[model samples]
Target: MSRAAFYDQIETTLDQMRETGLWKPERLITSPQGARVQVDGAGEVLNFCANNYLGLADHPALVAAGTEAMGEYGYGMASVRFICGTLDAHRTLERAIADFLHTEDSITFAACFDANGAVFEPLLGADDAIVSDSLNHASIIDGVRLCKARRYRYETRNLADLDRQVAAARKERPGQVLIVTDGVFSMDGFVADLGPICEVADRYDALVMVDDCHATGFIGPGGRGTPALHGVEDRVDIVTSTLGKALGGGMGGFVAARQPLIDLLRQRARPYLFSNALAPALVGGAIEGLRLIAEGDDLRNRLEANAARFRSAMTDAGFTLTGEGHPIIPVMLGDADLAGRFAVRLLAEGVYATAFSFPVVPNGTARIRTQMNADHTDADLDVAVAAFTKVGQELGVVS
Candidate 1:
């Protein structure tokens, strides 16, 4: 088609999305992210949609560290790592991450998306293969697509299916086989069975990689993530996670792995090679965040209590919720339009949550994914549950 026709077609698709209630709109947060935030049009509301699990986005210590680093190291790197972008702060943050995750070494990226995008192509070749969870993040899907390695997929978190897929991939006699999955599936809030996954990988002689973006700073004991949670930290081969969630809630991603894998990515990961180094402020804050997380049993306890409170109350009120023993609680509303409407009504009731629909999730699995933070109090949990209950009753979602 000609350029004009192509543009018109794109517009038509957008219109269809809006009409079908699949369009997602952004809310303006006038104040810093925390349990309570000021929305530009809606005023202050209890925020339940953020990934700020530890509630450190606006913490005083993180803010001070970031500010101090900016003053000490200047603002931006203005260059890539190999081209003089590597700052002492960068190395410090990477070391902190490796020490935190108990990995040999780690490499930083602009975001976990880039980390996922950069990982596959450098390590795997045409003679190799990747067996991925069916519901793995889109970045993993795209990363796998970019690699020339043969690909196989299994049902989400299904060990039997994974074993089958690995067996099939090995049948091809590939040089290397990697099994990858998300440590925590963000949409459903379900933690992967890492212990079992490690068992499967061992049986098949395949390496295991986990994208632990959602669990890195808060899921496991000492907040070491799912591998540690499952007592398989030494077994899992590679870990990719984000500093954007729970880790001061700034923005950066990294891959923690054995020394050789990290060394290879440092030399060849395009995102790290091409993107400007992380700002000094983010690095400094992340180091402090890691420190806080290392000694944050209190915060983790509070977070668990908040999640348990919300889940119990919502379930008792007759809302169908997904996931367990994790902070993410997705209130399932199968209809995309109904989910959107429910979120709007929630805002009116002084709760700030967003509806998730197709493309972000499967077509019939739309939900309002609520997250709990350590900063939230019992009163905040009560208010959120009340809002959800009222909205559910009004919309005939609950009795």
Candidate 2:
């Protein structure tokens, strides 16, 4: 195709996005990820959209750890793990993660995206089957598509549907069966019904896998994640998570499972075998983050308190919120245009947040997704609540 045709096609698609109100614009942050940030034009605003659950994104300890690692291990690895990229810090972080999660072994990846992308292709084949939750993360969906396994999707958080799906999958008589879900759905903050799911999997002799990216380092006692939260730590067969969120808010991911499974992944997982090793600074910072999680529950308690405060205030302000009292609180607005305007109004009122609409979420369920963090003070929450209240009332979303 000619360059002019290519340009015209791209421009037409961009026009369609703008016309449909689906165009997403990036907000430039002049400050670090925290309870408050400075946007490019907006001087400063309370941030309620970050995934820094434990307030460690800008923590001094993580900074120190990253700085120390830079001095000790230098900068980039320049090669993948299978080559000469593996460092002592990489192995140490992998082992630390395994110990933290009480798993037999673990393998690091460049990101949780890669970890999820590579997991299914290596473990399951044409003769196997995968039973997934309807609302599982997109990465899992893509991973399942890449694999040759027969696929089945159960209704979100519905055990009866899961049972039906698993039973149906069993009729195929596949070599192996795996049930996958996110520990905590990112958009709605609904914790997966892992206990029931595990029971179903056990009855059907299916393996259970959880992507605990949103729950790790903040959910459950000792922050061991949703498997522990649901009393199925030993029952979950595979776990994948990221260091990009609560774990110091850096970048990297890992898959934790039994020794043999991790060993097989190391040999066959394309993301692990082909991607460049995780940076040393991230590995070191994450190791420190894990240490912090293992050391105390103060951060977790603070985070939970913040979430409770925000949820209660929002509910009291007469806004409908989806899911339970978790950090990810979506204040439902229903209309995509209204949700977009609500977010803009929020930013103007000194609260920074983003709205979700169709394609990202179901239609007629547009909402402003607010994430609470340990770093947010009572004053900060009050400020955000006031903003929401004012905007919600002005927009006639609340009485």
Candidate 3:
């Protein structure tokens, strides 16, 4: 096709997206990620949309660590790890992560997205089967698509469905059966029932893998993640998480698993072998973030308290929420347009949150996915509660 024709086709698709209310527009933020930020034209707003659960995104310690690493390791690596890009800092951070997760070893990736993308293809083959939760992250879904493994998907957090899927996959006589799930379902903030899942995996002699991107920093004791929360840290075989969320809010991801798995990924993972190495700043900052998480419970306590307070207030105010005791609190609105208007009203009231509708979430389950952080003060939370209440009352969502 001609270039003009190609351009016209793309423009028509974009127009269709806009008309369908599916196009997502970026909201420009002028300040660093934290409890409150300066949104362009919106001025300062309490940010409840970010994944900064532990609030270390703009922590002074992480800033110092990054700056120090910049001076010590210089800037970019300019090459992949196999090609002279492996720094001592990278190894240090990987080791720190492995120790944190109680895994044999770990391998770093440019982002959790890359880690998830490169994982399955290197490990599972066409004869193998991967049984995954239907609501697993998009990255996991995409990664599974790229792999040659026979895929079996079960309903979200449905153990019975998982058992059925596993039994069905076993009928294929695959070499390996892997049960994969998100440690924390991002949209609804529901922590996966890892213990039961682990039991089910053991029944089928299948290895369990958890993508703990949303739960890595503060979901469990010492912030060791969902496995730790469920007391199945030793049962889970592989864990993939990101430094971009609770850990420094920088850009880096890692896969922590048995030494053999890590070794294989090092040798064969395409994204790791082909992509540029994570920059020194992120590695250094992540190391410090891990240290902070390992050494103390103060931040975790504060974060839990904030989440509890917010969840209680929203519930008491008659807003229906999904999920258990996780920082991600989804205020269920049922209707997509109402959810969008709710978020807009929230922003107008100086609270910044985002609405998740169809495609991102199931249709009719539209919600405002608000996240809590340690840095959010009681006053900030009160302001947010007031804003939610005002909007909920105005929209007749709450009596």
Candidate 1: RMSD to truth: 1.0
Give the Å shift of residue 366 in candidate 1. Answer: 1.9
- For model 1, residues 1-399, the per-residue Cα lDDT tens digits are 999999999999999988978677788889999999999888899999899999999999999999999999999989999999999889999999999999999999988999999999999999999999999999999999999999999999999999999998998955899999999999999999999999999998999999999998888889999999999999999999998999988999999999999999999988888899999999999999999999859998899999999999999999999998999999999998899999999999999988999889989998999999999999999989999999999999999
For model 3, what is the error of residue 243's alpha carbon versus the real structure, in angstroms, after optimal superposition? 0.5
TM-score, model 3 to reference? 0.99
Give the range where candidate 1 is weakest over 10 consecutive residues by summed lDDT. Answer: 18-27
Root-mean-square deviation per candidate: 1.0, 0.9, 0.9
Alpha carbon lDDT of residue 208, candidate 1? 98
Q: Which whole-number lDDT from 0 to 100 does residue 258 have in model 1?
A: 95
Candidate 3 lDDT over 289-389, as tens digits, reads: 99889879999999999999999999999999999989999999999889989998899999999998887998889989999999999999999999999
Stretches of candidate 1 off by over 4 Å are none
User: TM-score of predicted model 1?
Assistant: 0.98
Mark the regions of model 3 whose C-alpha exceeds 4 Å error after superposition.
none
lDDT of 2 at 228: 90
After the best TM-score superposition of candidate 1, give how far the Cα of residue 348 lies from its true spot, in angstroms.
0.5
Instruction: In model 2, state the lDDT of residue 133.
Output: 93
Worst 10 residues of 3 by lDDT: 17-26
How far in Å is the alpha carbon of 4 misplaced in model 1? 3.1
